[model samples]
Target: MNTRSPWTVVICAAAVVTLAMGVRQSFGLFLPQMGPALDIGRSDFGLALAIQNLMLGLAQPFVGAIADKHGAGRVTLAGALLYVAGLVGAAYATDAMGIHLTLGFMVGLAMTGVTFTVMLGAVGRVVPPERRTMAFGIVTAGGSVGQFLVVPGAQLLLGQLGYHMAFIALAGLIGLAAVLAIGVAGKPRALDADGPAQSVGEALREASGVRSFWLLNAGFFVCGFHIAFIATHFPAYLADKQIPPAIGATALALVGLFNIFGSYAFGLSGDRYPKHYLLAGLYAARGLVFVLFLALPLTNVTALAFAAAMGFLWLGTVPLTNGLVSQIFGVRHLSMLGGIVFLSHQVGSFFGAWAAGYMFDLMGSYDAAWIASIALAAMAALVHLPIRDAPLVRRPLAA
Candidate 1:
């Protein structure tokens, strides 16, 4: 079977990821406006997002397996349609239940098909082993690009056209992504020269028995918690401190901006360094950054600085984690295995988004959430140290 050029596939995968992730990242901007208009409490809105995360996690493995067998393009196209439908539904949603069905369930499920796991799996399969991490980094960076560009545009739309119309405009962008998904078509027929082909059942059985697989899942959980809490609540957190809404938008944008660099740098580093060590260091640094952000006085400058610092670290885990998976297991079932790992991340995301809002409503502060994030980061750092990152030596399948 013929395949597209590797670079062509990478670019297309990146574009698909850009739209899916960019749109997902901008949801935080809707919170302040959405709550008052829908008569939903912050916790209710947070629950919607929490449900979205859970659904995304729950759907990923199935979607990943489908992508593994069929192709990413079909799944992505389907996801784009669902995304548009969800946005339209969200636009006219009159109550929390409506919001939960549309924004929470539908969009979350769509994300499984459109976001990193499927696209990065496609990229991982096509690229050479040595270049795989950097390719994953580039695709992951594409999401950061979306964050950098889409969040501010979303804020602008929110300011002028209102939340409902903004959803329509974002839906249009997702429709465009459906076109890009065409280029990401085709599943890899065999593993690259480094390994022999393995059946999906064999891959799953192998991964399930490995301790490092679970460790990677545990470490990624912290990443999900960190990103989701910040993405969903940071803007509102800034607003609560009497910071202007525009600054919050700028801060999120900066994160996207810096993340572009962070993901790439880490991807490059993953090729050269021990990825688990890099991951351990990344988590440790996050804890340090959070401590400084809390200790410093609350101000626009400090907030933006924290955003830049956190953004630099944001999504860096994706490339390294993905690369490590490919390193340990081959790319034969990268999408499926990656989805399993990402499911854990999304579980953390569910808590991070929901728990923060729950605590804020009950205690009137996000202090507990921030403290939890710091602690989780520390734990993630420790977990990565014990991970065995060497490639698995599988015996050849019997004829």
Candidate 2:
């Protein structure tokens, strides 16, 4: 029997997520500086983030499988080192290709090893089912914490240290998460199955057959699109309106701050209510928020209010979506299965990040993207309604 406390796993995993995601949220803040410095357009910078999101999604299955079979600690440690490398490399990069390689390629692969797939999987394995969603909320909130705290710090670094030295500083911060990897170091425990332990192929095949899984993926895609577009482009979008840059940073920071509570509230509620229903409501609320934000006057107060509202809704989907996955398919192969679902989310992120910039370059406004967000929100709200939230009942192979 394992001796480590479940909370230990949660704390360590959350800490790592905080650093990984915090540094990540800070990237959009870099675009203002990077664009002028590298002589690149918004689309160029957007493409780099697009590549990173796509690469992260593409690599997740393998990384999750590795973590599932071997141990999360090793995977996390390696990812942390690679994350440092990517940041440091991006620091020195002078061209589009160079930024794409360092920031897009290397960091993308690194995230698979460090972020939600492996970390949440670790918690799923350790925390009891009754408490699993709450644990997920705590971990999901860690990313926001990073955003709240790290984004502003990154802004300060950018203003003071410039992008190069700022990146180097960020590298050192993520390097610390490498050591915390030890806290999550353990292989998946054998789960109770109808037959022998399911092979990775078997897990894939089973999840593929579940209709709700695909629906969950579709819903998550909207989430990815919304977050990727907003996180990467929202700062610049604000700058276009002649808003002070500091307000943009504060707006993102508020998102991070409020999401902490939102994640926890949603996570706690998931344990008490129907997860799919909660997810549906969350998406619907997001749609309403967007509508209000767009309809209101564009002022700093309105922007910050929008951020706070969006923040509460943000990342709440993570624990809820993940809870649905675990609720449907047990945690036996949670990492790999969740990774597949997340891959769908990342694909949307690629489009969201790239498309906004493309639209900006072509149309001179983010109006189209914002409208798309509203529509996607409506779609996501509808999609989760049909998901089958019951646990899967397995039949013995010999039956």
Candidate 3:
């Protein structure tokens, strides 16, 4: 029997992601400094982040499986150590290959253990079904909070200490999450004691056959693309127009700040409304936001307004998508199944991050990439329209 309160577990999971994701949100800030210093182009820098997103996706399911079998606490502790090492290594890296290996590969792998898959699974197991979406919202908001606070601080460190020292300083912040691991340290437990038992293999087979599951994946892919492209390149895009670098940082920080409200509000709504409809509306809103931003003249006011609008819509997808997964498939293997769905998101991220840079290098403007994002957002909104949120009904397996 567990002794800790459910909220205790939820809050700790939130804190860990706040640190893990907070530091990551600042990676784009490094490109201006790191790119010029190492003589690497934007494409190479973007490729490194693309690699990181790919590695992060590739490792997630295996890491999720391990967390499922052993304990999230142990997995999180090991990941935090690797996370610290990756940042420290990135700090000392002198070339593109070194950056890719440490920031792209190591940190990517490290994130699988510390971020959403493991942490949300921990929350899913502890909280009841009725409250799981709200709990997830809280955790997702924590990441945004990290974004709001750590990003500006990162910019300051860049000004005061340079990219190398900034990386080191970020490493120190992530290390603190290692101690918080104990809050989530345990194997997956029964959320509904009376619920039928399902093996991991059964869960996989059941989910694979469902149309809604695939739809969820399709929509989430666009989400990944939007996030990775904007997070990895938006600042540079602003800089290209001769906007001050500080506004770019402030803009990204505003996304984080507004998302804090967005995540919680969406989470609260998911519990009351049809999640599919909510998801569809959110995606459609993104398409509209992108279209308006592109049509308008670029300025400090426009950029910050864009950030605020996009931020509110940003991570709300996480809790809704995660809730959809749990709602349809059950949380028995959430870490693993959520990881699989997330793999699709990461695949989109790889392209989003890489393609933006590749396009910029070729075309010298982000207009094409922004157009692509708008189109993809429309596609995501359409895909989620047909999803049915009811749970799968399965016959009990033979003993």
Candidate 4:
């Protein structure tokens, strides 16, 4: 088999992923205005987002399975259109059910195409094995780039054109992601990444017996908690404490910005070191950061600085974790299996996002959520230790 141009693949992946994730991340910015416009409580807003996350996770396995069989171009193109439709629907949604259906189901369904597991599966297929981890890092970084750069810009656009127009504009940009997905065809041509390809069912069965896969899943639940809880609630948490809204936005964007560097750095590290140990350390570091942030005085500067540091470490684990999955399980059914693992991540996200809001509503403070994060992080660190980094014990694929 011949290799494709690295630059072309990387650039295309970055462009497409940035547009997709950029739009997704902007949802938080809308919360400030959206909650009021709809006559809903913050918990309601959180629940809607939690539903979106849940549907996103639930849809992933089927999407990944289909992508593994049918190639990603069609699915990606379809997802782009669905994404645009979902956003437009959201702009007009006047009731709770409308928001849930349009934003949760429709938008979440669209996310199946753009999310890291499926997107990185395509990346894993094209890039040589030696370059896979680094390549995945670069692509994942694009999503962060979108979050950091595009979100503030979207806020600016909203400033000028208003919320509805801002969303409409984003819909158009999301359509561009579909256009770019068409260009990512050299990889997943046959949906085969390794020498001997296994069926999706066979792959799942094989991986089910692996102790490490379950550990990875359990640990990833914590990751979801940190990401979604912060993404959905952090802004409000600061606002409740009298921090400026821009400060909140800035801190979140900072996470996206710094992660660009952190993701790449971790990917490079994964290339050389034991990925599980690195994963353990990343989770442990997350616990430490949260502990310190909660214990000290909260200020805009401290919040933003914390965001920047945490952001670097945030999505960085994705490349490392995904790389580890491919390393242990091979790439035959990588997309499907990886989707299952990510489902755990998203399940955690649902709870993280929902629980923070719920806790705040109940206690009038975010103390419980913060404490849970520290505990979950520590648990995730422990979970990573026993995952033996070896290939799945499997019967050969029927070829």
Ranking by lDDT: 1, 2, 3, 4
User: TM-score, each model?
Assistant: 0.98, 0.98, 0.98, 0.95
Candidate number with greatest lDDT: 1
Clash-forming residue pairs, model 2: none
Residue lDDT tens for model 3, 17-120: 99998899899999999998999999999999999899889899889878866768999999999999999999999999999999999999999989998899
- Model 1 scores a TM of 0.98
Candidate 2 per-residue lDDT, tens place, 1-399, comes to: 234689999999999999999999899999999999999999999999999999999999889989878878999999999999999999999999999999999999999988999999888888889999999999999999999999999999999989999999999999999999999997665651122488999999989998999999999999999999989998898898998999999989999999999999999999999999999999999999999999998999998999999999989999999999988988878888899999999999998999999999999999999999999999999999999899988886775
- Candidate 3 runs further than 4 Å off: 191-195
What clash pairs does model 3 have?
Answer: none
The residue-level lDDT of candidate 4 at 349 comes to: 88
Task: Give the range of the ten consecutive residues with the poorest summed lDDT in model 1.
Answer: 187-196
Model 2's alpha-carbon lDDT is: 0.92
Q: Which has the higher TM-score value, candidate number 3 or candidate number 4?
A: 3
Residue-level lDDT for 124 in candidate 3: 82
Model 2 residue 125 CA deviation (Å) reads 0.7
Q: What 10-residue stretch in candidate 4 is worst by lDDT? A: 183-192
